[model samples]
Target: MNRLALLAAASALVLPVALSAQSPADPIFSPAAVRAHVEFLADDLLAGRDTGSEGHEIAARYVASQFDGLGLKPAGDAGANGVSWFQRIGFQKTEFGQTPATLTVSGAGEAKRFTHAGDVLVGLNAAEPHLDVTAPLVFVGYGLENKRLGLDDYAGLDVKGKIVVTLRGYPKGLPSEEGAHLSATKGKIAEAHGAIGMLSFGTLQSMKARPWARMVQMADEPDFTWVSPEGVPFEAAPGLRASAALNDSAAQALFAGAPTTIAAIRKTADKAGGKPKGFALKTSVTIRADSVSQRVTSPNVVAILPGSDPKLKDEYVVLSAHLDHIGVSPAKAGDPADKDRINNGALDNGAGIATMLEVARAMAQSPDKPRRSIIFLASTGEEKGLLGADYYARHPSVPIKQIVGNVDLDMPLLLYPFTDVIAFGANHSTLGPIVAKAVAPMGVKLSPDPMPQETIFVRSDHYMFVKQGVPAVFLATGYANGGEKAWGDFLGGAYHHPGDDMNQKIDWDAGARFAQANYRITRAMADGDTPPLWFAQDFFGDLFAPDAPKAPK
Candidate 1:
């Protein structure tokens, strides 16, 4: 049967009255229901639900309609109707011009010239339309400076008025989120140390996970950021004059006369936990780049289900999922035999949003109402640097303090029958115990992140909430019952590809189970008297919410 027919059949079997009377313990997550939602959202007609596109607007309307049917009050920006189901977010899109970026290395040997998008990938500085820099090169290992962890790649080196070259990533054993947080500050760190330009290359392990060709392909895409009403783009790194990423060949050229090869440095850093030594290169580097910018607006679908307890109704627990995907790839042309070019992100995020929809349905229909309000947010522009979530965090519809916690669902690969789950950010808050309690009866085990090197924790929508001091967790199917191989295969073959369509195999039962687990976790958070708290000395809590109350000693 088709997805719509299967949904109709399932709905016919369950009477409306029975559904309304169903308890939280009863199985309300129907595989057929979930499949119907996924198939529709992931359909080719949606054009991969690209942010700000007509298809994305259609998906947003669909989500708003579902919220309306569930009796969820519109909690978004106010409109002519007094309330809207969408929190409109404005963005600044910056696309680098076709003017080929130029990079030249000179020293004791002949200077080599590298073309843009060929041997090096140069990033445009939106703050400046043009950039030109010439400085001596200095290797700064991972370019990380963390006083808390006593890691300083520039401890004994002086990079003043020079270009800093660094590899990507932090120490191997640090929490994945912490590593990500530190790595994100590399540019700022370089700027602080008087560096004028920055050159970065992926480590061998990192390059193996995501190839250089993929990175180069993404370099041409327009970079996006939520902008102010005055049309000012949010400046993430203020002082950097020039920045570029080098492929293996370009990196070798940069290190032509150096004593150690890039391979040797990568192997040493891998074995010693990202502690490679820093040294002044015998070569000097120069760079030039150009770019153009435009402004656009997108919507973040928002709704709320009020709590039964009058006193606690003001507090909220957020359930979030990104509705945006990579969208249609211009690089892939469709053939006459099979003209399918849309990404159709069935697993990357169609599964996540569908799961959120089911969870919302269950919460709305349950006889026992939660003590705290539940907010459903289908965010946009997550595929573009978490723009929607970051915007919401900065300009929340409600008071930021009233948001007690967040549970984010993103890309729960359900190709196999998963018996375990990996909950990123679970270790730093009370939400961890709540998840453990909620999933015990379901015969599902909560496991640590299987691929921490990828820094999965800070790569999703939930990290925005964490940055705003709200405790949060991102859930994913763990490596159990052959799930590891399934996940690896998907990441290698279909991730961000047009092949992640409805034609791919999926275990609907597993998807339903995953949704049910999330529903229970959300229910527990809403029904509990106490709100989730950050553990004592937690790095995120200390950094983001220093004055907030800590967990019990």
Candidate 2:
């Protein structure tokens, strides 16, 4: 009766095959752990967790301590022996001091003082004792000074301490043969001309993609603090620099008042096929700036689970998630959502951090460790143009060559039940197929990137590794599975807004499953014999071609 009864009970419980486990001994990802991590990281107490703030520091310490508790080896700074896990990455912070800036223009016998915050704007250049400029204004076409192209806007004349005014954007289309020869390039070319300040026309419209522009705007207001990239501590010649975009009407008025406008100057320069006699304007801007500079330190949390194989243990697999967010948003618009204020960044990255932790925990419980090392990096300042990852890639604890694959987990909140995963850089690299093979048995379909026009492949933290010739891939929810409303609801409401708070509306259970799938993929790469690679069609494919091979299942 005992054997018969036990057999009968087993048969009854396992009748349906789809519900049974693949292997009883296999390690399964723990959803409870992932939820716990996410809840804490996305908590209101974190205060939206903006980088370079006290809130950001608190999050960094928590992550570092977690790495320490994981019993993972240090893989940060490098010494004579090998490498350490903790590296000191510091940046010099700049503050626009309380010095008021004033702009004065004496045209038509009118001398008026312009306010810096409202009427005028200025930034720092070289750190000199002072920036006194009375040089004549020369209208340089985009200010390109490429020696290779035989185009030097300042070839005939001097612009060392002068003010240069330039047009914005690449012209409507390809330039004429003569125009191309002059090498009128991007905006950065204008800054290299040794001009005290540049008045940029029609360029501010493109500032939507620039963090510096946005930060400057916020700094003008009294309620919020602006955080910029850490410069090299102090400029060798820090001076007052002011730039502005003159509207069409404004440009017309300036041209009419000056000896020559940008149009007439360009016409003359083009006719000579070189720098023509320059025209000067009777305009001077008096910029009195108050600014401060200081050194700031931040850390990238690194924890590693060493591999078991004698041959491949030295190689590495990186699982990364940015621990930092945009932090608190200033309350404007007088709406309740704006008052919500905290850009808690639940989906932007708290989800990725929790997923990485869950994956690490699951692998730690496995019967066998991965063949190659698994490194978990909670990088900082991702919203600040991937600064932390960029810094780490250049100063990697392990040899960049030993890194086979990098899986960056970002924005995994809205998972679909039946749809394929939106795998980025799939076509750009061979890792796409490897990912597909790993998820196939789980009955999950893989989908090509649906929003190619967005050029999302170049965005996110993974791109940093990719830039260093490593194969990196990231997955996010796709709009193909859900209706327009569902897609819009998630992105439109919480993408980066204050409404991205921790509410029960998030499908945590589904998110946990997605995290588990990523864990399995990471495990496969970590233990496999072959490394992932960029596809032949990808722009970076040649960089890793020598080591590229079919990833082992």
Candidate 3:
């Protein structure tokens, strides 16, 4: 009962009515509101709030109770128990068996075998629990294919009945977001080309940027995927039954007798404007996969602010934030006596949920509501490949077509006094101008993406909505006014670490302004005469909503 009151007062207080000249123009948003929520959510009591765990359930219920207090309508599933604020989603967890999957490269004098957890990191096949497949190897520069872009990494090579060896990432010169989208379609393109297996390795540049040691640590974690209504996990290419990501030693051994050595490819990948052509390797590879699968479930807390206007009430705007983080870690061999193993994700997502709650409260308290209905979604399993958002997009409580736009709040680094902001995917749709106009009054500048090489356009929960033909924008504090160093320090040190707790020097002032900017953007989209639309010639717009009307950006 005491915790419930804490949840209710999470947005009540932290600072005075106003802080400085750079503070939000509106007094409704307060640093106190953002601080209280972060403090409670990131507290050690939640135990990191992993998906499907009791900690995360408490987090979901807290959001649901907050929605109830705001007088928002339940926007989830209908059952014999009546309507509820949770859209539950089922999931499947596939753990690789004790076999310790092996990948063997043959035809280079003698066959060489690489074992999982040592030379290779391989996930379960899911479709065929125990898989032993062998096929010829083909080197496809980046394994990318696009007709409009005049790029065909598999130009004249026939990859049918073969395993494709691809260099990680796309060409360096293409548009960042569009390039990212295409880079992510490697599996889809491989399946379309009739490939039966895949092997990928990081470029030297990428390996240097993000050390292979980090990848090794991450490989220890299990993988998760959402289950379909058909009771199967979603596999982009079910036919590509065997796949693995290789490290330097394994990659070098696999390219023993190839036309172009892996070292040459690595050098080419390091240089800008460098591209390699496709060629069949003088080798064949075999992969072994054995997996154990289990069923699990989680919920997406949903609530709706019904529009006041009858004509535009059907059109909806979604404001979403994830509520899950990596759970407590197992003790390492050489750990400190008093180690903090829990991964309390304060800025990673607790800040996002807090900001969204404040926005919902502001709209509910206002006498004048937007013309279009607003859906506040507290998603689950986002840290596990954006599963919750993907599920909600696939099985929306309301008609999917009625969802006009999405504003996703993920990790907003509020550790510095931010003067500008970066809104990913904004340029691809009309939502860009709306956000710019919305934040201009608050002395906040909308800056362009600085780390384009990271390819963050499709990393967060909003990408799911974009894939479902909805125009979406993901907002975060920009790399300005000490933000660059703050982001760098966070990503390098505390991200996903036990150190991401409430003890960090977080700037609540910046959080209040960020919340206000996002509120204005969402409010403007909901109240506008016309709903947000995709750009006339954008890649994502053409790919997802070919028949829908597109406005010039």
Tell me each candidate's TM-score.
0.91, 0.69, 0.95
Query: What local lDDT score does residue 348 receive in model 2, on the 0 to 100 scale?
Result: 74
Q: Which residue pairs clash in candidate 1? A: none
Q: Which ranges in model 3 have alpha carbons more than 4 Å from their true place?
A: 1-16, 19-27, 269-273
lDDT of 1 by residue, 16-52 (tens): 2222223456556777777777877787777888888
Q: Considering every candidate listed, which one attains the maximal TM-score?
A: 3
lDDT winner, 1 or 2: 1
Q: Tell me the spans in candidate 2 whose CA falls farther than 4 Å from its real position.
A: 1-26, 77-86, 99-289, 330-339, 415-418, 452-454, 483-487, 541-553
Q: How much lDDT does candidate 2 score?
A: 0.61
Distance from true position, residue 194, model 2, in Å?
6.7
Worst 10 residues of 2 by lDDT: 11-20
Which candidate wins on lDDT? 3
- Cα distance off (Å), candidate 3, residue 511: 1.9
Candidate 3: what lDDT? 0.86
What's the best-to-worst order under lDDT?
3, 1, 2
lDDT of 2 by residue, 61-84 (tens): 656655665567767766797655
- Model 1 CA deviation exceeding 4 Å by range: 1-24, 256-264, 331-337
- Span of 10 residues, lowest total lDDT, candidate 3: 18-27
